[model samples]
Target: MILTVTLNTALDITYRVPRLRPHASHRVTEVTERPGGKGLNVARVLAALGHEATVTGFVGGGTGRALRDRLAAVDGVSDALVPVSGPTRRTVAVVDESTGDTTQLNEPGPHVSPAEWAAFQEAYAGLLGSASAVALCGSLPPGVPVGAYATLVRAARAASVPVLLDTSGEPLRRGVAARPDLVKPNAGELAELTGSHEPLQAVRDTRRRGAHAVVASLGARGLYALTPDGEWRAPAPDRLAGNPTGAGDSAVAGLLSGLLDGEDWPRRLARAVALSAATVVAPAAGEFDAGTYEKLLARVSVDRVTS
Candidate 1:
């Protein structure tokens, strides 16, 4: 079973407008709300792919209640969140059809107290024991230590379970020290983690930081991964002409699902790239069309890089 950790879960709101013009009032034609946070998104995808996954974290307030309800509503996924003192976060994304660009607004999550942190740790420990593989995802919420994911990685290692980490900034920097089996970082996050503007070089740089493997999401360039075996690239099927907000999360879901199936590195990379492109073409945030994903899966091309 897969265990997904999301310390800062949210209600993600996505709006679609015909065009984005600065300082101009625009009417939204579409609106979507989903239970979000990287790990929750992972669980959602895992469920869609027919994988058993349990999610844990700090969830509180009315929004937290809604999030739990929504997550539970999705079949084959379960949550074991520890209730905290403050409300969950809310994130918004505005997509413009004409330019296919998305403008995002994010809120810093509520502060977690010491007691809440302790309870979360206890819940996570229990969840970790039951997991075959664990995915620690998303950003560090206020009051959580930067090395939180690192600690979880170490625990997973001790339990002999592979750990996948997906996050940004200092949390990622510190987490890599614990040597997670895999790390998924989008291009911008990869740049921050590896300090290399050249993306392929940044992927190599990530491996040097102790991740057993690094899957770097290259947006339109598709997926680039560097593992101990070798480096590989999988391009998306043609070019997608839509909002691409949740592409990376879909790619993470692909990688973990591939790993759970015992797929080789190349197949895993192809699956990730294809799922990401499908998410891009699907429209809205964190949503991928099943049919598009299936079709794109066949068209994704994976190649080895031996330089």
Candidate 2:
């Protein structure tokens, strides 16, 4: 089973409007809510791909309970979330029908105490024992240590579990030091980490910082990966148009699934790119259109990069 971690768990709510205009009242056409946070999003995609994924991290109060209830309904995903004293946060994503673009507002999440963090460590350690691979994802919530992912990566490494670290800012900087098997960062996040806007250079820099491998998500263009085996660029057949919020998470799911199955870089990149594009066209976050994924999987072209 794969383990995914979302330190700041949330109830994701999406609102759809005909168009978004500033400071104007508008009627909402639709609303969709689901359990979310980066790792949860990854778990959703993994489960949809017929993989058994256990979701862990912090959840609390009424919001947490509601999120858990929704999670319980998802197939192939097991809830092993640690409870805390504070309430789970909520994230709002407003999708405009006219443009199919999304505007997101995310809450900082509830504060965790020292004891609660300790409980989480114990829970994570136990989960690592069963997880074939682990994904450490998303932002750090208040009161959680900045090096939380680093600590978790170390534990996973000790247990002989391959780990993927997906995060940004200081947390990512520290986590990479633990030499996770892979790190998935989008263009912007890559820039923030390596101080380079050039995706290829940033990915190389990140690998130097400690990631065993780095996969840089290049939006509609697809993924650029730098690994010990070799470097490659996997581009989508075309630039897909739709909401791209959870696309990266889907890519992470694809990569993790392939990694655990011992697939080579080309096949993994093809799957990652296809899954990411599928999520873009899907109406909701953390979900991919199965038909679209199947159609795009063989179309994605992976090209080897030579120095």
Q: What are the models' TM-scores?
A: 0.93, 0.96
Error at 213, model 1, angstroms: 0.6
Q: Lowest-scoring 10 consecutive residues by lDDT in candidate 1?
A: 278-287
Clashes of each: 0, 0
lDDT of 1 at 127: 80
- Model 2 lDDT-worst window of ten: 236-245
Which candidate tops lDDT? Answer: 2
Error of 1 at 282 (Å): 1.1
lDDT of 1 by residue, 84-197 (tens): 889999888888889867798988998988788878888777887789888898987899988889988998898899899999999999999899999988889988987888
TM-score of 2: 0.96
| Global local distance difference test of model 2 | 0.92
